[model samples]
Target: MSNKTIKIGQLDMELQSIFSAFEHHVHTAVDTAAEKTAEEAVKKLKKTSPKNKRAKRGKKYKNGWKYKKTSEGMTVYNEQYQLTHLLENGHDIIINGEVRGHAAAHEHIAPVEAWAQDEFPEEFKRQVGKG
Candidate 1:
C-alpha cells in the first residue's frame, strides 16, 4: 500500500478567513448591542427622571438625557445642564452661607446599571453565540 500526503494550506486559509469574519461579526454585534443598550438607558432615565418643579412650567428633565458611544463602552448623560451629578446625588442647597435643605437624589444612573446588568450578557450571548 502507498501512503499519500496532503497539504492543508487551503484549509488553513479558509479557516483564517472564517476567523476574520467571526471577529468582524463580534465587533459589529458588540457595537450594536452597546448602542442599543445606551439608547434604552437614556430612555429609561428620561422617563423616570424627577422633573424640576422650579423650572418653567412645562420643562422636563427628560430633555436633558442623552447618550454617546465611548471607547470602553457607552455613556448616558444629561445635556440640559451640568446638574446631573447634583440631581443624582443629594446635595445641600446653600444660600448666603446658610444651609437650606438637602435635595433628594433622583438616581438616574441606577436604572442604567440595572438595565446593563440585564441586557449586556443576554445581548452578547445572542450575538456571538454560546461560548
Candidate 2:
C-alpha cells in the first residue's frame, strides 16, 4: 500500500470548522479592544479639572452662511454632531461625532486647540480662532 492516504470522513470538515471559529473569536476580541480604548479616552477627557457636566445645545451656525453643494451635488450644510465647551482661554473646541453606547456623543473643550484646528477647520476658524 502507498504511504499517502486521503481522509474522506468528518475529520477534514471538522478541521475547517475549527479554524473558522477561531477566526471569528479573534475578530471579536480585536474589535472590543479598540472600542474600549476609545471609550476610556472619552471618559478621561470628561474627568478633567472642571469636574462639571456640560449642557446640551444646538449646533451654532455662523451668520450669513449659505448652503453649498459638494462635487457630487449633495447639499453641504454644516451638519455636525458636536459638543461645545468654553475654556479659560476664551476659545472653543468642537469634537467630531461618535456613537457611544448606542447613542451619539460629541465631546469638545477649549484646551484642545490642535484637534479643533485639524478636525473642524471651517467651523474652528469661524467660531473659535481668527476667521
Give the candidate number with the greatest lDDT: 1
The local lDDT score (0 to 100) that residue 26 gets in candidate 1 is 88
lDDT of 1 by residue, 38-118 (tens): 788777787777787776843456677888877778877777666777878979999999999998898877767787879
Clashes per candidate, residues 3 or more apart or on different chains: 0, 0
Model 1 per-residue lDDT at 98 = 100
Q: What is the TM-score of each candidate against the true structure?
A: 0.82, 0.33
C-alpha lDDT (0 to 100) for residue 114 of candidate 1: 88
| True-vs-predicted CA distance for residue 6, candidate 1, Å | 9.4
lDDT of each: 0.77, 0.37
Question: Model 2: what TM-score?
Answer: 0.33
In terms of lDDT, model 2 sits at 0.37
- Expressed as tens digits, the lDDT of each residue in 4-114 for candidate 2 is 455779668867887887677655554444334333333434443232244343113211112333453212222221212222223333446543333222333333334
- Lowest summed lDDT across 10 adjacent residues in model 2 is found at 57-66
